[model samples]
Target chain A: MAQFLVEGRELVAEAARGLSALALRRDDAAAMEACFRALHTLKGSTGLFDLEAMGQLLHAAEDRLAALRDGQASTPGDIDALIEMVDQVDRWFDALERDGRLPADAGSIGQAAAHRIRDAGGAPVMAEEQPAQPSWRIPPDFDGLSGIAIRYVPRPDCYYFGDDPIAITAAIPQVTALRLSARVPWDSSEPYDPFTCNLVIEAVSAAGRAEVEAGFRLVADQVAFAELVPAAQAGSAGGGPARRTLRVDAARLDRLADLADDLVIAKGGLAELAAQAESLPGGHALGQALRLRQARLDRLAGDLHATVGRVRLVPLAPLFARFPRLVRDIARSLGKKAELVVEGGDVEVDKALVDALSDPLLHVLRNALDHGMEEASTRRRAGKAEAGSIRLAARVEGDQVVIEVADDGAGIDAATIRALAVKRGVLTQEDAARLDDVAAIDLIFAPGLSTAAAVTTLSGRGVGMDVVRSAAASLGGRVTVTSAAGRGTQVQFRLPVAMTLIQILVVACGEERYGLPLDAVVETARLAPGRVVPIRAGWAFQLRDQVLPLVGLGELVGTRRAALAESQRVVIAKVRGEPIAFAVDAFVDRLDIALRPMNGLLAHAPGMLGTTLLADGSVLMILDLAELVA
Target chain B: MTVRLDGAVLRLEGSCHLEDAESLTALLQTSGVSLVDLSACQSLHGAVVQALLALGPRVEGIPASPFLRDLLLPALLVKRQAKPSNL
Candidate 1:
C-alpha cells in the first residue's frame, strides 16, 4: 500500500503535467497520449488493491484523454475537469498514505468527479448515435469481416473548430482498414480554402456498433455506422550508457546511510589499533602491516560514505513540476495573471533536504502568488506585463545549494512590514522607525507579523515567512530577502548540500578536542599577552577594529580553564552575525566528519551540536556556537 | 512556431497548432517549398493538416503517433494519388 501511494503520487503528477500541457496546446498529441497512459497505469495499479473508487475515477479520466486524442472537440472546461479529477485522485492518495484506506467519502467524491469529466462532453462514445448510413462503400476484402463500418463526412468549417477527421476515424476501436476520399470532386482550376474540410472518412472496426460509435461520438452528427458481416475465410494483416533505477523506501536509504556512517566510525578503531601495535615492544613491523591495512580500510570507508551520499541525492525536477498547475489555479482564483518559471530543477540534493523543502517552498510560492503578485489591471498601470512572473531557481554554489524565489511583481513594502511589526507589538514604534529598509524587510521573518492586510484562504495567516525562516534554520541554512520598490523581491535560501556530513574546524582546550562548524568560524588569531584585557570577571579581546567578548572553551564546556599563556590562540566565531572570541589551547586540523546527534541521556545536552569519531577512535564533541553563545 | 521552412523543406514539429496553419499555407505558396516533414510532429491542428491536403505538397516522414501516421500519410498521399494534377 505504501509503495502504491508513492508511485501513485508520481503518476498523478505526471498526468497533471501532461494535462496542463494539453490545456495550453490542444493539439499536443504527445501530452494527450502521456496523460492517457499515466491514468491507464494508475487505474491498473488501483485494481491491484481494493481501490474501486480511484480506479473508476482514473478510468473515466483515461477515457476522456483517449477521446481527446481521438480528435474529439474538447470543451473549454475539459482540461480543467480532468485536472480536477487528477487533484481528487491526488487527495485520495494522500488519504491512502495517511491511513491504509481512502476516506469513507472517497466513493462519492470519485463518482461525482467521474461524472463531471464524462458529462463534460469529453466522455468516450459508448453507444451509436444513429444507424449506419447505407452509402458507406464497404471494402471488398472485408466481405466476410465481422465488425462495425463507419463513414464520417465532417462539416466544412470543422477544421476551424479544431476537428481532425482523420484522427477521429483512426481512433475507432479495433480498426482494420481505413479509406479517405474527397466528398466533392476537386475542381483543379479553382483556388479553395485549405481550411475547408472536404474528406469523407470510412473505417472498418472489429468491434460492436456501440463500441465503434464511441470513437466517433464527438462527431456523431457527421458519422454513420454499419455492421460488417464476416466472410468465413477473411484474414487480418498485422542505453547508449544506460542508467537503471530501483525505488527503495526512503527509510531504507536512511538506514543504509546510518550503517555506512557506523562503518566509517568503526574504521577509526583500526588506526588506534595500528598505533597501539606500534607502541608494543618489537611490534614495529606488525604495526607497519596494520597501518597499511588501516589505510586500505580508510579508503574503502570513504568510498562507501561517498557512494551513499550520491545514492541519497535526488533531482528537484519532480518537486518543481507540481507548481505550474498550482500557479494556474491560484492565478485564476485571485483574478491575477502569474506565471511560475522554474529553473535548475536538475540540481541534485539529499533526499532529506528535498523532502524538508516541500512545505517551506510551497508556502513561499503561495506567498509569492497570493501576496507578491498584483492584479492584471494593477500590473498594466504599473507598466509591467499583465502577467506577473515568479522565477523559482536553484543552483549549486560551492558546497551549498541556493534556492531562490524571485518575483517581478510589486516588491515587498518595507514600510508596511515595519508598521505591521509595530502594530503586532513585535517591535516598539521607535524600534521600527529606526530600522533601515533591509532590516524592515527582514521583519517579515518575525513571527506573528503578516504583510497582508487581510487573511485569505491562500495565505496571510500570519504564520508564514517565519516558518520558512525556521525551516531553513533547522536545515542548517539561512534565508535572506532583498526588494526594490516597483521592481521585484528575491528571497534566497542558502543551505548545505547535504546534512549527513559536515566540515568542522577542530579545536583543543584543556586536553580535550572539539569541533566547530567551519561556517561559524570567522578567523583564528594568536593574540599576544595583554592584548586580551579583563573586563569585569569576563575577558575581552581586541581583533582589528572590534572588541570582542571572549570566553575560554574549557570553562564554557565545564572543564578547567587553561592557564593564561604568553600568546593565546583565540578563535573568532560569528553567532547570529555577532563576532565572539573563544580562547583555545591549540587549533587542530580541519576535517569533514559525519556528526551523530547526541542520543541517550545526552540528547538534550545544551550547546552540544553532536559528536564525531576521530581517526584515533576518540570521540569529538561538535559545539553549536550560536546556542553555546546564547 | 511549430511550422518552419528550413531551406526548401517545410518542417512540422511538436504540436502544430491552428496558428501555424496560415504560415504553413504561406510557406507552401511562396517559399518554393518542396516537401513537408511530419517526422518530428506529434500532431497537427486540423487546419494545418487541411493546408497540407489543399496544397497537395509532397510529404515525407511519419509522425510518432500511430493514429496520426495512419491517417495523415495516407490522406496526404491518397489525395495526390487520386489526382496527380492537383499538386
Candidate 2:
C-alpha cells in the first residue's frame, strides 16, 4: 500500500510535467496520452486500497485527458484545472500516508473535482452526453487469464437516474464468480426503501482492467476494482515500481553510519595494537599476524564506510523541481516575469545536506527576485530582455558540488553596497573607502548589512545574505558572490560532495590541534624568511609567482602562539576561488575521521567544525577553513 | 451460504467465504462426483478458487460473473488438469 501511494505520487508529478509541456503550446497526442497513462496508473493503484475517492478523481481525470487525446480542443483553464487536480491528488495521498486515511472531507472534495472536470469538456459533445455505454456484464463460464475483483455501490438514488446496479455488475466481462451481498449489520436498520439501492454487487472477472473500468464508467466514483493475484503471488503483486525502490526507516541508516564509524575507530585501535606488539622481544611473530589481520580489517572498514555514505546519497532533482513553480509564483506576485532554468540537477548529494540546503537556496532565489533583478522597465532600459532569466546550475567540481544561482538584471552597485556598509555601521567610513568592488560586494555577506532602501515583503526582513553564507558554510561550503553593475549577479555555493568521514590535514596552532579538510588544501609550504611579506593583519606567503595572504592560526582562533621561527608551516587553501594561506606551528599526521556537528549552543558557533577523537584519545577540532578565512 | 447435496450432485448459492473451504473440501471428498452447480453462487473467496483447483470439481452452471468466468475459469481449468486426476 505504501508503494502504491509512492508510485501514485510519482505518476501525478510526472503528469504535472507533461501537462506543463502540453499547456505551453504543445498539441501533440503523446502529451495527452502521457497524462492519461499517469491518471490511469494512479486509478489502478488506488483501487488496491480502500481509496475509492482517489480512484474516482483519477478516473475522471483520465476521461478528460482521453477526450483531449481524441482531437478535442482544450482551454488554457482546462490545463490549469488539470494541474490543480494533480496537486489536490498529491496532497490527498500525502494526507493518506501521514494520517492513515484521507482528510475527513476527501469524498466531498473529490465530488467537487469530478464536477469541475465534467464541466471542463473540450469535445464537440460531452462524454457524459453520449448514450450510456453497456455496463460490463459477466459471461458465464468465460475464462479470464487474470481475475479482476470489483465492488460496486451506485448512489442510492442512481436508479432514479435510470441506472441499474445489477445490470452494471452483470455486464462485467468474463466473470467466474458473482455475489450480491446484503447484511443488516452493514447497513441502517431503518425500513429499506424499495426504490433505493441497498445492494453491493461484488464480482470476480477475468477481463482486463480497461474493459472492466469501461463497463462501470457511469459509477466509477462508487466502485472499487482490484486486480487480484493468487494469494501465493499477492505479496509480489503490488506492482513493478514498488519492487524497484524501497522505504527504509531513517533511524536505521543513522545507526548503520554510527556503527561504521565505530568500526573505523576499532580498526585504528588494531593498528595501534599491532605497532605496540612489534616492539617487544619475541613479539615479532604475533605482531606479523596482527598487522596482516589489521590490514584486512582496514580494507573492510573502508568499504563499510563508503557503502554507508552512499546510502544517504540522493539526486538533487527534488530540490531543483520546486524552484520552477516558486519562481513563477514569486515573479507573478512581484509584477515581474522570470523563467527559471535548471541545469545538471541530476547530481547526487548527501540527503542531509540537501535537506539543510532548502532554506539557503530559497533565500538566495528570493533575494535574486527581489533585490538582484531589476524591474521589467529597468531591465529594458538597461538593454536587456524584458523578462528576466534566473538560472540555477549545479555540477561536481573536483570533490565539491558547486551550485550557482544567476540572474540577468541590473546587478549590484558596489559603490552603493560600500555606502550601505558604512551607513549600517558594518564598516567604518575609512575602511569603506579602501574597499574595491570585489571587497565591497563581499560585505553583502556581513551580518546586519542590507542595501534595501525600505524593507520589502519578499526579502528584507532583517535576515540577509549572511544567513545564506552561514548555511552554505554549515555544509562545509563557501558562497562566492560576483556582480556587474548592469549585467546581473551570480552567487556560487561550493560544498563538499559528501559530509561523512573525510580526510583532513591535521596542523597545530600552539598546543591545540586543528584539522583542515583535505579538499580545500591546495598545498603545504615551508616559507623562508624572505618569502614572507608583511600584510596589514598577517603575513603573505610568496609561493612561486603568487602572493597569497597568510593568516596566523594562533591570531585567527585566539590561541597562544609559539615564538617566531626562521621557518613556518603554512597550508594554502582555495577559499571562494582565491588562494589564501594559514600559518601553523607544526604539521601533524593526516587522517580520515567522521566529524559530527557541534551540539546545542555550540552549533551556532562559526569557523570551527565538529570535533572527533584522535587515536590517542584527544579530541581534534576541525576548522571550517573558508569561514576561518572570512 | 450452504451447499445442497443430492446424490452425487450439489448446488452452491449466495456468497461462500474461506471458512466454507474445509466443509466444501470434505463434501467433494465424500461425494463421488465433482459436478457442483455454482450458477447461483454470486461470490467465492480466493480460497474457494484454490479449493476448486485442488478438488478438480466439474462445476455445472458456473456463476455468471465476468471476473469469475474470465480469471478463475482459466485458473480453474489449468488447476484441474494439474489436480492429480483422482481427486
lDDT of 1 by residue, A461-542 (tens): 5567999997898677889999898888889999878756778999988778989999889899998998988999888977
Runs in model 2 lying further than 4 Å from the true structure = A1-12, A24-34, A40-60, A84-125, A128-238, A374-387, A428-439, A484-487, A507-588, A616-618, A625-630, B1-87
Q: What ranges in model 1 sit over 4 Å off?
A: A122-124, A127-243, A269-291, A321-345, A375-391, A422-436, A455-464, A508-513, A525-529, A555-567, A585-589, A597-606, A615-618, B1-87
User: Interface RMSD value for candidate 1, one decimal?
Assistant: 2.6
Question: Which DockQ values do the candidates obtain, in the order shown?
Answer: 0.21, 0.04
Q: TM-scores, in order shown?
A: 0.66, 0.60
Error of 1 at A548 (Å): 2.5
Best by lDDT: 1
Q: What is the TM-score of each candidate's chain B when compared with the real chain B?
A: 0.91, 0.78
Displacement of residue A265 (Cα, Å) in model 2 is 3.3
Single-chain TM-score of chain A, each candidate: 0.73, 0.67
Q: How far does residue B74 in candidate 1 sit from its true spot (Å)?
A: 24
